[model samples]
Target: MAPGLLDRSRTVAPPGWSRWLIPPAALSVHLSIGQAYAWSVFKPALESSLNLSGTASALPFQLGMVMLGLSAAFGGTLVERNGPRWAMTVSLLCFCSGFLLASLGAAVEQYWLVVFGYGFVGGIGLGIGYISPVSTLIKWFPDRPGMATGIAIMGFGGGALIASPWSAQMLESFGSDSGGVATAFLVHGLVYAVFMSLGVLLVRVPAEGWQPPGGKRPQEQQSRKPLVTTANVSARSAVRTPQFWLLWVVLCMNVTAGIGILEKAAPMIGDFFADTSTPVSAAAAAGFVALLSLANMGGRFLWSSTSDVIGRKNMYRCYLGVGGLMYLGIVLLGDSSKPLFIVCAMVIISFYGGGFATVPAYLKDLFGTYEVGAIHGRLLTAWSTAGVLGPLIVNWIADSQEAAGRSGAGLYGLALSIMIGLLAVGFVANELIRPVNPKHHLPEPASAAGQAEGTAGHEGGAEHKEATGR
Candidate 1:
């Protein structure tokens, strides 16, 4: 909204710019907005201060997730047109303002205001910010799209790692009451606003003729096989393709499986051994949660980078195929052996995190980078779907079986079985992902020029390199 904010001339990267800087620019936004995951740190405090039930306290977070998916799906094309600077700035404003509004809501004890502020407003920020870096990163690192995106998305996973402890410490230093929570929200808004501006200022789109050092055009590189089509698919056309929906199912199932474990990490371990000889302790359960966080964060970088070597399709095969077997191992072996449980859960979570990190590159592979950001944005609805589905599948089965007098592992048996089934479905979908039909490809000249432009820019060509310290 600032004057000359979306100026096209400012976005184009100068010749000889270091591509490595792009990751940090992307990370700046990802890390700040990724604080959404740390909402759980506020959950208990909200419940206690507001005298709400567990489910009631979770509404803001759940709504935020729902809004995140919806906003991303709707705003994807806009992000492509507006460029990353516009998207990141918008994200910064909305994200920070959500916290401030939520702070006011918490201070006044108006639960609905908190929901409107954090859930509705903040969700928009998450969606825009999440896709802001993808297209740019892919363009900047055409040779390593997977690694570039992994670096940014990994920050999203790691953001929770930073925020969880930071928030806990803040609450401890202040007080655990409503006032303290309000203060925490206020501080988070202020701090993150400052932090995310780094991305807005630093991110750049490549100049029209720019290319990575020694990189060849798709035609020149014909001898090498690419994982997906070099042909461009418009975002609209991309959605019409079966590849889009199949990948949707793939992402949805993968996320659902991960969220199943993530949502119940602290309690599930304890319950698994409650009536068993092992008798898991509270500290052990806490450690399990920490382990999952580490795995989730680490996997984002590790597995996604690996995709570059193995190809995106094969990488997902490992995620869904190998991941399903891990779930099966947990179902049969987790209750009986704590070591096995931890190992399986850790690996499962790695695949889960891997799934998130890899999807952008996968989209690029399938659809091309022209609208990869927008396509990726539309695909995040699957995450929103999984957010609801994962927890539902786990909780519903656990509760139903518990009421039926099942105990320990028996309570989770049906749920784990269902998870395996979902993975099987995802595996089939991944296999179904053939190359996009030639019908969907953009004709040659326009497609070549579009890709050559590297990234979209605003109409006015005013300089913005000053914003990035050029």
Candidate 2:
């Protein structure tokens, strides 16, 4: 697509445009970036071909995650100012080029190049691509923001499910050697570059005065529930609010607890059952991982959509409250029964995925849709923090406990106990949340401000313009 053709004003949806198409645009971006989760499929190949240690081979993924969060945090305002089309275009270039660069790095036996390509370049793609469609989706589906985000974010969870086996098959057929890995990387870059362009082309911002079919104006809706404040908070202002930090803690703790288990899932299963009557084989462990992926994908859609009906805060209460209990179950009954262990792990992962999908809408609820993409981008710092912290806590504890003669569920007890405490703290933070103070809301426009001061009759109509982004 031509760069000039994608001007933000030119990309606004027509009056009758269907919002259903928006989710697919979002999926095209998310599904591609979500391949970050499938980096493990390349780990053994990188290690074997380059003769690198496990820690050395992991640098690309770790650095990529850190860059994902940092780039998103820094680039968020640019994305909002330039609009989704611009963001999607930049994401496509960086993401695809990273893969191509990584392919070259592999072919030349330069591991640092691979790290730079995928970690730094591709990680920027992951961050920008992840947030590109969020504000657009929220604007299009004002009445069902949670469900809209669920559809898009669910693609991120499912991306690994699609990529892992597909990449494995490609590696198997081409060969697991460095040359073969390069070929796989080259193919991935080319294919994803083409795939992600669909988002760049299809995405649209809502035109002025656009609303869902027969939907009421923002003022009318807010009048029905005074709690749903109709006010904008800039990203700068948002970060200063107590609500933002509370949410940061909520997301960080929830993600930390879930990711710890997910990071060590396949091996954790093996160890937990190693001395039991039913030992989990490598194949069974793979199946367990697949089940967790399914639960993750399902929860992104199911639990997030449910949040639309039940309210974002209430749904998170279920996530932390019930999720904490599920972890307790795993810690207590994990060694006794395989079925119980599997069930508890599945539910916990579901909540983990659900938390990611629902948070954007939660931001919409608390901060308003103005600059939500940027706010959401800033909030992802929590994920990066948890990404490092969660794995460190779990892996370090498990390793130290094993060295000290602990085995099975005992290795995880300390981690799970810590997770429960984090959840309790998050629950309290959620309870502390209240509506944003009026002083923090965006100043009313001069005309709107004048009308409100001059006449009570004009106040509703004036406020409606500001609230609806008209």
Quote each prediction's TM-score: 0.93, 0.92
lDDT of 2: 0.85
Clashes of each: 1, 0
lDDT string for model 2 (1-470, tens) is 65486566567676777888899999999999999999989999999999989998888888888888987899987787677888999999999999999999999999999999998999999999999898888888888888899999999998887888889999998898999999999999999999999999988876665666775454216345433666767687899999999999999988998898899999988888999889999999999999999999999999999987778889999999999999999889888889999999999999999999999999988887767888999999999888878889999989899899998878889988988988888888878888888777766552233222212212343355458574
Clashing pairs in 1: 10-464
> Residue by residue across 1-470, what tens digits does model 1's lDDT show?
65495664567777877778889999999998888898988989999998989988888887888878887898987787778888999899988999999999999999888888999899899889899989999888777778889999999998888998999999887787889989999999999999998898888888876766765443214445555677878787899999999999999999999999998888889988898877889998999999999999899999999987788889999999999999999888888888899999999999999999999999988888767888998999899889889999999999999999998788888998899999999999999998889898766654665575444422211122223232
Candidate 2, 282: how far from true, in Å?
1.7
Q: CA shift at 361, candidate 1, in angstroms? A: 0.7
Note the Cα lDDT for every prediction shown: 0.85, 0.85
In model 1, how large is the Cα lDDT of residue 443? 62
- List runs of model 1 lying over 4 Å from the truth: 1-3, 214-223, 275-277, 455-470
